[model samples]
Target: MLTKRIIPCLDIKDGRTVKGVNFVDLRDAGDPVALASAYAEQGADELVFLDISATQEQRKTFASLVKEIARHINIPFTVGGGISSVEDVAPLLEAGADKVSINSSAVRNPQLINELSKAFGAQCIVLAIDARKIDNAWIVHTHGGKNSTDKKLFTWAKEGQDRGAGEILFTSMDHDGTKNGFAIDPLSKLHALLTIPVIASGGAGSMGHFADVFALAKADAALAASVFHFGEIQIPELKTFLKNHNIPVRL
Candidate 1:
């Protein structure tokens, strides 16, 4: 059986790791390199570093910070934010990112997905969709969950897969930073619709929440930030807990 993955997200703004509720009221967490190294030591399956303001500022990702984090961690790392074209992906991969996640850029020009898949292969491209429940439907949000796109979550995910994206990182804006629980209802709906691996993001408060996401949400992986960054939860211990609960994990 394929073991489920636990991922830690680092939202960097102005070169510092930060966290916020529903993508607002940001607070500094720590240095990106230090946090990446710590998560690596904790046996996190993967790490996602999103330069939250890259697109809004009309700038590329932080290659310097990427290099800094790359120097210390050996695990698979994904870098995202403001990545529009193949050119933007180069610096990130050069800085040692195992995968490049595209959100706003891909939503604006979906062909960017085909181009990335052609240039870097599907496995190297990750399509990240930040969604929020709107009137009983999940609407796709872009620009660090600040703007909404016309496409729905399911349609986008299916199209992303068709465009050759290897995986989808689906985040729930409502549950984000709430530390209540993952939005399993939408996650399960998306998981059932997509064949590509789904990485669930937002609202991971406890080990039981992770287990709930994996079991009920049918997510291939769960991604969280505040809990792990603030030391509220430990990755290895969480893995053992998942294992004890009969969840398939790399313990």
Candidate 2:
């Protein structure tokens, strides 16, 4: 069986790491490069760096910051936020990102997924979907979760897969920073629908929550921010916990 992955997410705003509840009222976490190095040293399987304000600010990801963070970690790093085209992806990859995540741009132009997958190979493309449950259906959100679109979650996942996305990073806006748990129902559904790996993001409170996402939702990976950011959970401890629960995890 493929061992599940534990990823730490760094939500960046103003060149520093930040985390917010329901995507608002952001608070500083730490310096991004320092946090990345710490997580890598803690045995985190991967790191996700999101320029949380890039799209809203109408600018590209800070390549210099990405390069700075990349130099400290020897793990796969995925970068996102305000990435709109192949041109935008080159600098980040050159800066040391193993993969690039596209969210708002992918939704605005579905072909962007295809173009990116083809340009960099599907394995290097991660489609990030920020969604929330609305009227019994999950709707996609953009612009740092400030705008909602008519697109449904599952449909977009399928479309992204068909367009050659190697993985789906699904963040439940409703459960974000709640410390409750992951959105298992939708995660399971998406897992069943996609051949690619599905990364369950948002609402990770404890070790049990990680196990639940893997056992109940069958997510290939679980990504969290605040819990891991504020020392609420440690990657080494979490891995030990998952292994004890018979969840395959890299120790």
Candidate 3:
């Protein structure tokens, strides 16, 4: 089996790293460049830097910060927020992002995924899906989980894969920042239905929660924000705990 990955997400807003509950009530975390570099040194498999407000604010990503953070880390970094087209990805890649994540923009134009993949490569694109449980099914949410779409989560995942998305970063809006645990039912369904990697996000409360997501959800990777940002969970220790649980992980 491929070793599962542990990734730390840096949600940037106003040029500072921030964390929030269910995608609101933002609070300062730290300097993104500093945080990214620290995570790299501490053994984070990859880093996700999301300019959380870009979509809502209707602006481009924080290129200055992206460049700064990229310069600080050697590990692969995925940058997201307001990335709308192939042109948007060029500067991000040139700025040193290994991949660019698309959320609201991709939902708005599904074809954008195909264009980006063709222009760059499937390996350079990651589809970030934020969804909420609605009427017995997971429904996709856009603009940082503020709006729900008619599209079903599973269908969207499959569509993204068909469009050549290399990976899916699945985050449950209901579970985000709750620290209760992951929404495993949806994650498991996604994992079984999609061939590409699924990165489970949200509600990772403890070391055991990490174990549960992999064992139950079958996620390729697990991502968290507050727990890691506030020092509630440390990357190396979490890897060790996963190792103890027989979850394949890089330590």
All candidates: TM-score: 0.90, 0.91, 0.91
Estimate, for each residue in 1-251, the C-alpha lDDT of model 3 and write its tens digit: 68999998887886777654222222323667767777787889999988766454433437767787777788888988878988789998998889999999999999999999999999989999999987798899999898889888999999999999999999999999799999899999999999999999989999999999999999999998888777788888999999999999887
lDDT of 2 by residue, 1-251 (tens): 78999998887876777664222222323677777777888889999988867454433336778888878888899988888999999888888889999999999999999999999999999999999999999999998799999999999999999999999999999999798999999999998999999999989999999999999999999998878766788789999999999999888
Candidate 1 lDDT over 11-35, as tens digits, reads: 8886777664222222323577776
Off by over 4 Å in 1: 20-29, 53-61
lDDT for model 2 comes to: 0.88
Better of 1 and 3 by TM-score: 3
Cα-based lDDT at residue 88, candidate 2: 90
C-alpha local distance difference test of each model: 0.87, 0.88, 0.87
* Prediction 3 global C-alpha lDDT: 0.87
Clash number by candidate, in order:
0, 0, 0
For model 1, the run of ten residues with the poorest summed lDDT? 20-29
Higher TM-score: candidate 1 or 2? 2
* Clashing residue pairs for model 3: none
Which candidate leads the pack in lDDT? Answer: 2
- TM-score for model 1? 0.90
